[model samples]
Target: MTQQERRRGRDETEEERADRMWGELIQEVRVAQTGVQILFGFLLTVVFQQKYASLSQADQAIYIVTVVLGACTTGALIGPVSLHRLVSGRRVKPQAVRLASRMTFVGLLLLLVTMGSSLLLILRVATNNGYVPYLVTAVILWYLVCWYGLPLWARRKHSSDG
Candidate 1:
């Protein structure tokens, strides 16, 4: 059967759509949260490293900003858990799912900043090369393409005909 003919309530009832979307959203968050948590955890310990004390003032400033971004990433990623816990029995899964999805997106954005800044600090310290900024910019652009550009492109390319 064609797409329209096989659908009940436009391919799914509200509850069904919510359940499916929530499951998918949770899975995506799990993937994002794990990476962010690991990176954030490592960022948390940087200040204790003996090398951290020797960093230039500029590098230290960069490290601080990176760590802050990492913390934001962690919070946004964990936001969904609190959301689910608070709304579990309230029959508001659909809205919860939407809000969680937005949080996850914000979390991903923060993760990108965390990663880009971390890379910048590392490369600057490790090489002190004049080309580090260019290299970091390239890496950031690559990340933008992979993490955001492709997904957005696909979303626009394959949207439903509604």
Candidate 2:
């Protein structure tokens, strides 16, 4: 292997590494952006529905909060693209990638909240069962496990293996 490959697992310079990471980050952001945007669109229509007026005050409050969370999630997920556009050719890609990654992470967390709140509101409206909160909590835990816990566990395990 070449010296650069031996040092970094690829025969690429810092610029190349930054380029690859930026591409990967954009692909990841696209997936998240699609989901959040769709969800936000649906949320926007909820308030206009005739059924929405029949919802309890507390449920309406939950709906409002969920919509706001969805909006914030959408902004954060889309932030990286705007960041890249504004910073292109500025020779600060590495720093930009780092910031974009942070934005994506925050976006994901907000997405988790948005989904959880949406689920809670839906369940509360669909059924009068006392088990709604518990069910929503369980689903939130599942999202946590799938979206974060498992990846973190695997990262910790495999990083040590290397």
Off by over 4 Å in 1: 1-10, 160-162
- Report the C-alpha lDDT of model 2 over 1-162, residue by residue, as the tens digit: 655544457667888989999999999999989899889999999999999999999999999999999989998999999999999999999999999999999999999999999999999999968999999999999999999999999989865652
For candidate 1, write residues 30-115 as lDDT tens digits: 99888988888888898999999999999999999999999899999999989999999899999999999999989989988888
Deviation (Å) of 49 in candidate 2: 0.7
Best by lDDT: 2
Q: Compute the lDDT of residue 37 as modeled in candidate 1.
A: 82
TM-score of 1: 0.91
lDDT for position 103 in model 1 = 92
